[model samples]
Target: MSHDRRRALARHDKDGADRDSGGDSGPDRVEERFLRPFAVAAGDPDGSGPGPGPETLDLLTLVVAARTPGRSEWLRPEREAILRHALRARTVVELAAEVNLPVGQVRAIAGRMIEDGSLQRCGPSRPLARKDILHAVLVGLRSL
Candidate 1:
């Protein structure tokens, strides 16, 4: 990870620690600690520069373990956590929720992992709802 990224993560950790110790509680603190980095990374809060744009991966996109192992030594602690969590099939949102990191940050990290073969993007495959299946069966029975 870059120096700036490391700093941001460190700050995030500190913010979490502070919140745990009852140092700060409110939306302002949450926004400062969580959303500021994204705004800064996007260049401007006003959407002036290149911005985050549409290149960011979808939160619901599924991720799976790659055929090859990643070089853990080359990864940051945060990225290592992400890779470990991805040992099984998980979505980008799932990974973020597991690690308590912002979805955008997780997406960026997962994108790098995909590029370097540490992870693979998988197609979304949620199971069908049981209620929906039963409803369809009932409709079919009525038609019969």
Candidate 2:
């Protein structure tokens, strides 16, 4: 990767880490840490920029949604929009704005998702969430 690309992605990763430490404390940032590097390496195949391949983006999106703050519901268009666009959403307020929803509603959903196995808490201070499905796979491997 070009130095400029590396730097940009590093910046993105740093930003992601910051978001991981914020509210909602859900699944988004955990997945970003692993996938963003791959996305950067893949480059904009269409010559657009640092975006990853469509498959990768979709995988990461699913992982992000699965790990989302609550419900583990099907990927709603609004939630997908937030993941596709916003990179620094820690609170329901930020997520609501990203997905154009009422903060109360988002908060409820986030809480539900976290309660379900769809998301796992990272730490008390850190607001990171790991997609349970993906995490299960990792756990399975670690056991082997």
Candidate 3:
């Protein structure tokens, strides 16, 4: 975390710590109301520049943890919460709901997680078409 982000989180943490005992307490888990619009994104906390690779993420895509996050670098609270829920395969949309963050913000975070190799994306499973089913059976009867 940057100095500014650490200060912001500390200020928010101090303000929030006394009043909200039920909520999780952490730098990354700062309540949405306390965060500036751009601060909600994990990659670019200061929001001075755009973060990388949000292009690959969509709400329907599923993500799962590739491995445990690194203690030194990956300890941000928002990401930790996201990883906890993603221990099982889940869609980006589901992660958003579980984390209590907006879908767009969650998408950005998930995109970074995928980029960093902390999370892996799963392609959406679709039902096979009738023609696809027939194609599989027809291969056994083909004539030379």
Candidate 4:
């Protein structure tokens, strides 16, 4: 709020002058650094400064655009194999062993699949029990 500082700023603004006005003034130095092209450009690539590359943000936006709610998409190979063994095996532990993955990883993937409507428990939530309807149908067919 000094009279000199206020007058200088008013002069610069009224003249529509670039902040880099031909002098080593304090405001000019500050504006030179802050108004540099790289400072203001979003998604500066080359890792030369802050923020992500344009390509990275663009790819993320594309993925978000592609996602749909409610119905789950078809599985990747790893997800399919994990779901298969989870349904066939007696326990999460058993499924993990069958798939040769850590139990925690198996459980996390299975939980996501179920939440996303891609997989469901065939019977009661407990493992080791054969699905009753499937078992009875198989038994009666064997008699035939």
- Which candidate would rank higher by TM-score, 1 or 3? 3
**Candidate 1 residues 85-117, lDDT tens each?**
888889899999997788887876677667657
Q: Candidate 4: global Cα-lDDT?
A: 0.44
For each candidate, give its TM-score against the true structure. Answer: 0.47, 0.29, 0.54, 0.32
Over 1-144, each residue of candidate 3 has an lDDT whose tens digit, in order, gives 476875676587675444344444543455555733536655545343563445567778889988765573354777888888899899999999998888777887788878778899976477578898688669856852
Order of quality (lDDT): 3, 1, 4, 2
lDDT of each: 0.67, 0.42, 0.72, 0.44
Taking all chains together, the TM-score of candidate 4 against the true structure is 0.32
What lDDT score is found at residue 98 in candidate 1? 95
Q: Which stretches of candidate 2 lie over 4 Å from their true place?
A: 1-75, 78-89, 120-144
Question: Who wins the TM-score comparison?
Answer: 3
Per-residue lDDT over 1-144 for candidate 4, one digit per residue giving the tens place of the 0 to 100 score:
576885787686753244335445646555556432322122112223432222211111111111222223243444556555544324556665776765555555454445445544443444344587689789999999
Cα-based lDDT at residue 46, candidate 4: 26
Q: Output the lDDT of residue 108, model 4.
A: 52
Ranking by TM-score: 3, 1, 4, 2
Q: Is candidate 1 or candidate 2 better by TM-score?
A: 1
